[model samples]
Target: PDTTVVVGPGGSFEVPLNPPLTNGETVTVIVTDPAGNSSTPVTVEAPDTTAPAPATDVQVAPDGSSVTGNAEPGATVGVDTDGDGQPDTTVVVGPGGNFEVPLNPPLTNGETVTVIVTDPAGNSSTPVTAEAPDFPDAPQVNASNGSVLSGTAEAGVTIVITDGNGNPIGQTSADANGSWSFTPGSQLPDGTVVNVVARDAAGNSSPATSITVDGVAPNAPVVEPSNGSELSGTAEPGSSVTLTDGNGNPIGQTTADANGNWSFTPSTPLPDGTVVNVVARDAAGNSSPPASVTVDAVAPATPTVDPSNGTTLSGTAEPGATVTLTDGNGNPIGQVTADGSGNWTFTPSTPLPNGTVVNATATDPSGNASSPASVTVDAVAPATPVVNPSNGTTLSGTAEPGATVTLTDGNGNPIGQVTADGSGNWSFTPTTPLPNGTVVNATATDASGNTSAGSSVTVD
Candidate 1:
């Protein structure tokens, strides 16, 4: 039954809907006079013309990074990444009613995946849901060579590799069905030890797996001196060398050239006949057997003499070396061998003339001869420069022009020395003032380095 309202004559009336009308229903109203006369009726329609389907059959990623579902074509799909009712991202569905939405941070495996489809008119469908997958097993990685390393792991997992010290070296991802491989940009050396780990889509990493590689070392190099004191050797082309002392301690290292030639010089000269240990190593850390050698290539000690004109000469040299004494003309005068104490002495055939140049040579047991050490003879002394007994510290007189004048105390300690001018006049002042009654001596030396008898004086 329809309800009716009556109003007082001479006015319009207002109607209020307390409960509101149902959607999609039509209503009609008619006006009549008190005499029971009916007027024309008016009709009105309610709002609501369209409905869009919400997303359905949603599939969530095992890692919870994204979700996929079917929605009305041309509709937008939104995902609630945080499991909250509100969507964090919205993506338009393809014409075929397919849609996919990604989440920056993957959701939990057991977390609910809420998704809704919004139509062009802003109408939203019922939300859909799908569960995430479970975590898979850790990956199994294999050993590697200098180049490629292959292994197997959970599908879509990332393989991370590091050196034994936990330094990152390389990384790769596994394909569907769990097969994976990694190839380093550079070649790895033999005997290189490394660790490998697997990272799942959820960012969970597996325990590290240790792997050791084997490599072959180059043949022991032939280490010899490069003409002098440098250590030179040959090894695998492009390899390197580590040098050690007799005690097998590292002393130096060097890389081989393209031709496998390497050389290294010590900061200081090594002692003669010293033993140095050496080994050849490659980039892979593989090393050849240590090769040992005695450093006997050094020259023998140069022969020397105490006095240039002495009838007998003595000096230290390599033990068991042959020492030969020769005149200025290169004629051998005498020969001797150094004793175990490295001491040697040689005497000329007779008293040698003054100004004679004597040279000595030493040949070590290895037949290496030393450079000639020479001394000139100074037999005839220069005329002693004149000095008065009361001259104090001043000493001056005449001798060979350009000769040296030496002043000394009675005890032979040199006071001073001066060279005569072209005119042969010379003088010297004592660095320490002379004391009265002190005895001083003076001598003169010619260009030949001949010293004259000492002339004495008592300081005034």
Candidate 2:
């Protein structure tokens, strides 16, 4: 009989009939069938073992506790249990898979950090998260100091303090015991108003106290001219003299001395016409006021005569000449009468004498002497002028040559005439030359209006 088996192309084929094939078994069968005769048949045996298919669907727990599902037996499991973005801890899965990833320092509040679990199969898990707490509120602040000028504070006449916003801080009066203070809860920002105030507990402030802080002193009182008033001697020079004040003061002092002198120097200057208590104090301090006395500053007047003495006897005084005397102030003091020959004699009532430098005045009933006259009385006479040509009996003098000579008196009166020849000698024939026994007076006058004294000649 013929038999045939079908096999895939390019594929290995083994066949066994009926009983299972064993190792080393061999069999043959005829080939072609259907219309033709077959050729050969073949036999094969199966081998024993083969590897199993790779495992699938590996996974890890969502809480990162452990890994599960099918995987290779000795596979590694890892977890970033701290969620610190790294796989820090590891576990080896024995034939049954399990692991414990301790919560890495337990998660913080409000944090969303990631946790990863990686398997030996190279797979990772999702991240884990936690949250944290919020921050606290800010605190309040305040500041203060004791006083403006004194202990624990600055010393000044004026003080100003300000607040954090540069606003001035308010103030309150110090206690009755004269103490000042301030207290605050918290520190102030830089340049905040502290406390600046002053307290004068004793209340002893001077009117000038306002000047003390600036180191200036008070002004002093002023004194006037500082010298005393002047005094005079004579009432004719006037008595009521006024002393003027150089500065402005109220009270003044004035006084007059025993010699009719008045003056004063005041401690402070006073205004004009300021009434004063004038006390005339003696060396012993005995004082008087409103004393009455005559004041005089002028010299005594010179004595005078209507017809001056030694005045060439012009007319005889029938009623004996009278002379008047007066004082320097032009006030008449007294008069004196002259002797019988019209001689005048006058003695001043005042003892002051010649060269005494006084004003002399006289008034006649005709008012001709109304204007006063100044007189320096000198009773002494002037020295006589000397006579030049000697007293002469006859002049035997020469004349111009060949000229006629004329005899004349010393006053140029012609007494006689004579003629002379060329010799210039002339002799008078004396019709009446200078009468004998006559005493003739001779005066020579020069052309300069000077007259020499007369010379006497006795003719014999």
Candidate 3:
């Protein structure tokens, strides 16, 4: 008995235990009555004294930030994060017998920890061990040009590649040097971003890294109509483009603007018939197939004109070219087409006057024109001469200056010639004395090669 109580009226009394009994503890109590009367002794039992079961399946987080396990319900759990033989953290098991303990400053990777569970009655279970897993680091992705992707990660870790939608696409493993590579079954489109993660053997995944797929090359550039001196085109926005000639010589380089437009002017003009090749390169270093354009910048050859007889004119020019005739004052005269054989002819609507000049040009199909060619019209001849009667030994005449005078026999056979002086006076002595009644004839010719009608007279 722990305490005694005085008897009350009707023989009723009470006894109190000063200190509570421990789990599974027992105590015997006896009742005492007045006049030294004694009652039977009885034993009272306390709560259960069994210790909690040892924590099972103890696991430390891969990041070492937490510990988790199963234990007896309503039990207290202790964790020794540093394995120092003392608990650094504690937690109470839930009604479901599951517990989780957090570490303030996460334990180092691969660190070993100890865990124990104790019941409410103060009975402790055997210790359990858990280790913090070493998580792999994010991979370093390399810049790629095609379908193949490569990177570096922790050695012996598995690498996983996923599309932007988080769908798994491929898998590989890092080598001893931490280098890894993956090739998709099918080619990826250009500018596709893929996610990559490194997974260690313990099933711990690292933060995701990204790599952009650039398997498809850019579309062939769209070239604008250009002269040989300057080039312009459209390509992938912000990409670099290179120009080359037919002989594969580098001409120049330029970058496409935000609108995909590009232009370049060479220091020297490119010759006609140049085959220019252009290639587009994107930021990822992928080059497109060469696009080609032929240059047609040269003008047609100058035309050749024949002498005009005042009525009809003829010439030669580049085949299929448009021939245009203009006068000395640049006024349009007539237009004609050169035949396939390069032959061309032009006839004035009305006969041109003597000494009129004509100019001709040839324009090719490309609209390039040749230099002008010229010809002069000359159709009229000089005036006839005036002859004087002859003295047989000295035949004289008044005629156009520079005119030649001749003497002939009555039969119009065998003649002698002489030229008129600047004063238009002329004389010619017959090699033989002209017989009486013999005739003489004279004629004049101008610089244009036209001959005048002859004048005649009889000799004395």
Candidate 4:
């Protein structure tokens, strides 16, 4: 028999052994305390050599909470969480039969963790699961910036904000006053690219909306021929024109001045006579389509002469005598006649004295007439002559050797003459410099009487 003792609150007592025990023999043991208390007789069938069945009711603490439990004395509490078939956490039960199985690791909200309690006996309990309440989903994000200018995005344009993951953050409508706003954090992260999908309450976003955040403006569009007024004149290659706004900010620049005008000849020239806009813009992004002008590429016609009238010259004329005239084109016209014995006469097929200009081509039929003779065929005398380098006027120019220069009055009469020195320089000591607005004729005659075409000089 196997003997054992039982102890009560009052005193200890002996256990009666029955049927002398033998190794591996089954036996029963009973014990009574002094207080007459007795433990239910324990059957000590030979030492329980067989392993104890696995523990029951083994479980991990509830999720998000902790747990405490008792384990077999001197046994290890093995926990297999996630059911991967491996022990994650373990706690050794001391001889005192106290043990604690902690949750494997902290779990996130909305996550579930399974825990299996295993004892040193190599037996495991069914897995116990704990779940964390789902956390609030990341706030939806929605936001977009836009413009209120002509291109699009007028005030009252709807703007939607979305989350970084493209989820709708919130629903917002614009106010009638053309403005709308949302409370911060009622949505997701601030300053994020809020994909503001805005639609007018009228369901009108067909054209789509543009956005400008935090007072930023959209990129300015490119404008051609920028801004300026129209110009008229012959514009040749290499010419440029100035372009500026009312405020004087250069927006478009083109070269035309070199060619007497500006040319915007496109790579593909605009169809002939095509009217186009010549726009100007300001630096502030303001534009002016109002100042546009039409383009006319056709040039003006050349002038023509119109004198077919007959005319006659009187008085003694030298062999080199010349007559001055004018054609319908305003070009100087001249004619000359033969002379013999210091006398000459010219009768034109067309009558003169009608303010026409003519040149007299008088020659000895040998040498060129001393500077082809030029004569004015007007009923009245020529306009008053205003000499340049007038009386006492200083002259600066290259003069030919032995050059004799003479200043003439309105009637081709000499006013003053100067003889060039050996250095080809000559100065007439005029009474005074020529007065402004005065017209005068000048003639340079070589020693051979060969005179140069008359030149007119006007004082500034």
Candidate 5:
């Protein structure tokens, strides 16, 4: 992606490169025409004339665990791990003095390593010998806390403790039995992470151990089910479930079952329409998130009956809710559901009588029932009838028995009226013989005002 311009016919160009090229390197360049046809590529090599500086200051690591040395940068350093002095494996030396090289099979205290350096062109330097370091394996750590790091290690080895940042905290030697502990000068900060290592008398260090301080809180309890007073839910096993009312007063407590299922019966009965909170605590006094369950013992509002009384009782209630109709004595008369529209209806086996007292109640989806609503049934009229004595100037009828009869002239002008006996019969004769061809009609009304058809009679 570099820009260059060349002239036509006898064109030639030069490509520029940045600094930092190594000796004994080669680069090839190719020229292409505007149509992408390529010319022969030209090759060039940079000559290597200088050898690396001699290796120096070769020495053993503090613990003699590895070979460390200084050499010319970019030189390969060989470590004779088996001490035969001819290099076994060679490592590229980084840009520093006394860099460490790990021994595959770590050298024991009595073992030695012979190290040599070589330049890129294969020039070798004089050899140096280093003794191996002795160290125990990393310690097994557990239950370490604010002040103490207790664990198992090689018998009589010392344990060193440090914060996660590798800063020293404390150190202690193991007992003859291989148990060791290090107590920091001060308690470990809550939630701080710490690392530990084991060391032997030979000045070697083991791998570091890492641990995080534990103060984790438990998970919150889950409350479920329709009734708040009788709650069912999950919590940590063996934890205690403590319940409290909205006022923050203790209501009761119970232990969670082995499966983490729990139930608590409040010392005081939880009333409807109250909010309550529950907390779970482990034996260690670690509390779980607060679980809340609101007491909703309240049913629904008393259902009202439209039209007050009828074969079918209807009213408004919770949608998809169960509604019950009861007599004054609290006996269930009928049951029905309030539709999704929040409307409900119930019809009893026997029609309710006039002035009868009844009760209406509504239930919520949660099974809460409303207080009974008092309803007084209104009266119902009796059935209608037919008349008799069609042509005698006399009025007679078989209608509702014990009904009252009102007679009128053909034009509907009222002439007189009478009450029917229990046999359902009624007659009304003119006090004087009727004038020839006069017409009369009569209607019968029950005690409840249910009326019968009219009877018309002509004079004899």
Candidate 6:
């Protein structure tokens, strides 16, 4: 190497080599005083060829934006982001062998990058490899239930909630299990939309996830009239409806149809007076106020009827119930309400004919009617018979046809019995002759068993 003159402070002077000297080469230097006295020549060695150690403790930013580590002091750290065996960026190690390099177009998570350390001597160490750190993932949001919002994310991440317009609404952190929840300060109207993002400790934010809010509860259900095991109702379309007993035990569940109609049949029959409760819930799990109905499955008992007397009919039925009377042909005769004691009486506007059949039924307060009870009218009695004067041995009388005449003496002693002929005539001959002046009395009984007043004649 040729010598070149260099000027510096008194303590030390630096010399430049005209043709750069190779590593580990030797050079000779000569010094002369200001006066004419020469000094001996001295030999000096150039930098050695040994390379510095590769970067140690290398770490990449969670977002892959930067690389940092320790290296030999004064060593230059070169970063190869693409694994192409070429440095894309470099940084000089500082006093404590610490260096950090910022990367443009940062590496992605799990991407491999090569690092090499070179000292001032131009010697390079073997390349070291590092992987970009992973970042937090987007948060998962749950369906809104008209009351609160909740979901999951990476553990320890901060959750940022925003409205559909990108306005910040709330912030919270995930628990150790990556679960989180939030209740809005005020009610969100139905069909509101929101967004959520997860931010890591390194200030890196994941992509935003959009969520639709459903905040409306279904309307109260309208139950239909029912008296059997099955119940049906109307509610919000597509709502889930539940059936529960008075005590809140679950009975069954059903989903409403497009027309808002729903039905459910219990596994077992409910007893009379059992209260059934119904509730409707929308898709977002918002529940409506409960509605209730009482079961009235039992019908009134059959009425107890007395035989009709052509003009009036009477019966016993459930208290405070309505009793209706119908003829054998099912024509309405009359209706009356039973008293508190369950006794009812109905008088026809027009007198019913003898032998007319009357049927009675009682309807209770719940409008349930019992089976019919029937009775036949037999109010007329047979006419009195005419007894002819007779001797002690024989007696005769005129009575209604088809009737039976029973004869007796004036003392009320039985004489004989006889049936009337087609011409309404009857005769009875005593097995023993009656005494003189004994009175013969006759009475008539019609086919319906109605008896007439007696007529008397004196025996000659």
- Using all chains and alpha carbons, the TM-scores for the candidates as numbered come to 0.36, 0.16, 0.40, 0.26, 0.31, 0.40
Give lDDT tens digits, candidate 2, residues 1-460. Answer: 3333565576445444566544346556555645676667555444422222232333333333343334334544444444556766655556664333344444332233333334444544433322222111111111212222222222222222334344555433344443333332343333343334342333211111010111111121111211122222211111232332223232333333334444444454333333322223322222233322222222222223332222111222223333445546666655544356544344453344433333334322211122333444333322222222222335344444443444445565655554444665555443434555444443332221123344444555
Error of 4 at 415 (Å): 22
lDDT of 5 by residue, 88-157 (tens): 7777988664456877666775577777778877777767777655557889887443656688999988
lDDT of 1 by residue, 1-460 (tens): 1545676566766555545555457667777778998778877665543557767778877667888878889877877766668888999889898887887767664667778787776677777777776545556766455576777887788888888778888988889978987777886777777787888777767767776764676788887643226677787777778888887777798888999988888887666667777788765456788887677776776866655445566777778888888889998778899999888877666767876787888887545689988877666777777775454556666667777888778888778888988987877767666888777787887754467887777887
Off by over 4 Å in 2: 1-324, 327-333, 336-360, 363-369, 390-460
Q: Which residues of candidate 6, in runs, are more than 4 Å off?
A: 1-125, 128-130, 220-238, 246-267, 283-285, 289-460
- Lowest lDDT 10-residue stretch of candidate 2: 206-215
What does candidate 1 score on TM? 0.36
lDDT of 4: 0.45
Which order, best to worst by lDDT? 6, 3, 1, 5, 4, 2
- Model 5 residue 396 lDDT score: 68
Output the TM-score of candidate 6: 0.40
* lDDT (10s digit) by residue, model 3, range 331-441: 888999999999998888897778789899998764578998998876676578787777688878676676555555656675777777999887777777877877777
lDDT of 6 by residue, 43-149 (tens): 88877788888889998887778999999999999999877888999999999989999988887756878999999988899888998765578899977864677
Q: Cα lDDT for residue 99, model 1?
A: 82
Model 6, residue 220: distance off in Å is 4.1
Quantify all predictions' global Cα lDDT against the true fold.
0.74, 0.35, 0.81, 0.45, 0.72, 0.84
Ranked by TM-score, top first:
3, 6, 1, 5, 4, 2
Q: Using alpha carbons, what is the TM-score of model 4?
A: 0.26
Q: Give the deviation of candidate 3 from the true structure as CA RMSD.
A: 17.1
Question: How does model 6 fare in lDDT?
Answer: 0.84
Ten-residue stretch with the least lDDT total in model 3: 442-451
Q: Candidate 5 vs candidate 6: which has greater TM-score?
A: 6
Q: Tell me, by lDDT, which candidate is best.
A: 6
